[model samples]
Target: MKGVDLLDLKKIVVFLPGRLLPADCRETKFHVSATVGFIHIVAAHDYLGILDKLRVPDDVRLYFEYRELVLPQLREAGVVVEEPDIMVAFLSEMDLPEPGSIEKLRAFVQDVGGFDLSYIMRDLQSHIVNPERSTDYYRIMEEFARVPRSIWREFKRRLVVSLEASKAGTPRRPFRFAFPMTDCTFMVASMDPDWPVIGEDGIRMRTNAVELFTQAAKYDLKTRIGVGLLISKVGDHFLLDWCLIDEPWSANAKLEDLLSTPLFGPARERVVDSYHFRGDNAEPGT
Candidate 1:
């Protein structure tokens, strides 16, 4: 029988489970779509490729939502748009913590007020920099679900998965796809030949999709895409500093465009890109 062999380690895709997505997802600037919020969290943890390999399924009919603003810029020039999010599991490297031995995090948290999240994040990121404390920190996150059990259970789930995943140095967004955007006529794809039973393919799908969009820009596809950061507005301008997917592509000219649009403003709150980058204030556009 011509089937995916269990002996094939190179054929599986490592992916991030949707469960890792927080229930406290914030509102997107201008509410372009779910994608604005999606990009931010994925940008953190270097795209969190939990596994290493995958053989793409024969073909799958996929529906992707890109920043509408960029679609026109890429399509007008006939450039194919693709954003591949992979459910990866076999990374050769992983982001392991440096093993800080301070047992009490209260000291760390106390140094920077939790209420002053920006200060806490910038000064006390070490509190959750490792596997041991990462989940511990989040389970207790003030910003997490009001219910304690919800946060704790989810934290445990993520920790277990993180331990089992392939530890490759996960790459940040902005990679280019070996394949240009193509219309496969929307076919059925294997969840990715790697980790056939898991969500590795899902992670890979996102990674690939991101690459395709970035390439669209190199092709001189001019359009500004705004990845809705967890943080919203501060004063007259929202802190459009932190970039989730190194390259934010969209229909606007800059991040500021969202502010001028019907749905966004500098006074709104900023959303975090997952647990990555705790707090940030306004900065000149990147």
Candidate 2:
């Protein structure tokens, strides 16, 4: 840590995709996290309302500046070894497919305000072990299948607001995964599908991506969600760098629990403070 320059390490920011917890859970909150180099630097939004994209670059730029200012605090806390060279942010949102681009779109709606797949898996596991309910898999499957339709309906409702507003003399911008907030980007890097199988020697090895993709494709069920970083170079230049592309949903554990932690407000506050972000930054009808 003494000789390492924090600026030389990669800075990563993660904006977790918003999702609903199990029906039994009591809270619904959006989540985010950041890492400078290997350090889980101090910090940590249910941001469902509209965001002003015109103000985002400036706001994010200030966030980077504030983090730079606070680098020493993070270092003193021993969370970072060196100053991160690249600054990254991860963001995700529900997006409508581009006209005639259904194949390119991810069709599976994320679980929101309903039963999570995790819950379904648990139920399935219980049924598998309970002989009396082993044959009820189809019923469980049917119940699980309802989540996507629910998610899609919610998204479609949001979409209608955007469309209606646009028709009423207020044009809305398309969202981007990297920027405007989830689908406007032109390039989507492919995801790696290899699973990590623990070997006999106590090491984990990755499954082959090609094989995984091929298998999923056979069922027409191929989609990749990943941990990606939005890297910023000089002023106003940003790039989306995929770190763990095609990571399986099960591999994403921290994201699910992020909002449950105490660090959320402070983390977001530092960034918001940097830009003096106000709810009024959004234009009327935005």
Candidate 3:
């Protein structure tokens, strides 16, 4: 950021506010901002957490120092693209009106696309859809009508694929469309509402990560559970970036069937290896 121009950095941040899955953005609305202070802080975190996580394979460790740090640093320095009002409008369209309300948040989780809305119908059903000769069955259905069982089943398939991918060198890339992993052209995430988005001209930003995590879990890929993703280029060399965010739960948390994947480990090395990803270009990878 020392050598980078502030104008360029702002552009990068405005372009890629990673769509948050539901649980992550719950109660939170997308708020676009371009305060210099905020940008500086975010860049620091990238230097600390994200950069530290990248593993320069023993073979390329020495040779890749420049590209590894310079490119990201440039993006980090130039992340102030959009104004705050635009973000407010974006949040309005998404139905996320400020934070702190569960009802509005739940409706948003159901309406949104990707993983956020996918699991709502299913999760709600699991809690209520019972044939027991009881009255609570109806009450449960009335109360928890967010996740549908069918969507959960689809999410289960993805979970299975992720588990299998963990065993294989290539983890099955997650996307909303039916495109192959190698065809994807974009990679993004969100931690706080103020996170940035990415582009060639600007540094990529993470938008509404809390919802992203929720959506990831609803779909069963559990990106938030512990997996940081890497996006590479091969077929056409389009979007060759990736993301690895925070871990799910904690070490002390008990293992459950919902979180049975192999996407977590020594951060840097894992992202480096996974970074070999080549988006299918026709699909979306996040």
Q: How well does each candidate superpose onto the true structure, as a TM-score?
A: 0.15, 0.17, 0.16
The root-mean-square deviation over C-alpha atoms between each candidate and the true structure, in angstroms, is 26.2, 23.4, 23.3
lDDT of 2 by residue, 114-198 (tens): 2122322354433221225443444334322322222223333433443344334343332112111221111111222132223
Candidate 2 ranges beyond 4 A from true positions: 1-37, 43-89, 92-111, 127-286
Residues 38-150, model 1: lDDT tens digits: 22222223223211111111111011122223334443565432122111101101121112322211111111111122332342323221224343343323222222222
In model 2, the Cα lDDT at residue 255 comes to: 39
Most accurate candidate by lDDT:
3
Of 2 and 3, which scores higher on lDDT? 3
- The CA lDDT at 153 in model 1 is 30
User: How many clashing residue pairs appear in each of the predictions shown?
Assistant: 67, 13, 50
CA displacement after TM-score superposition, residue 135 of candidate 3 (Å): 18
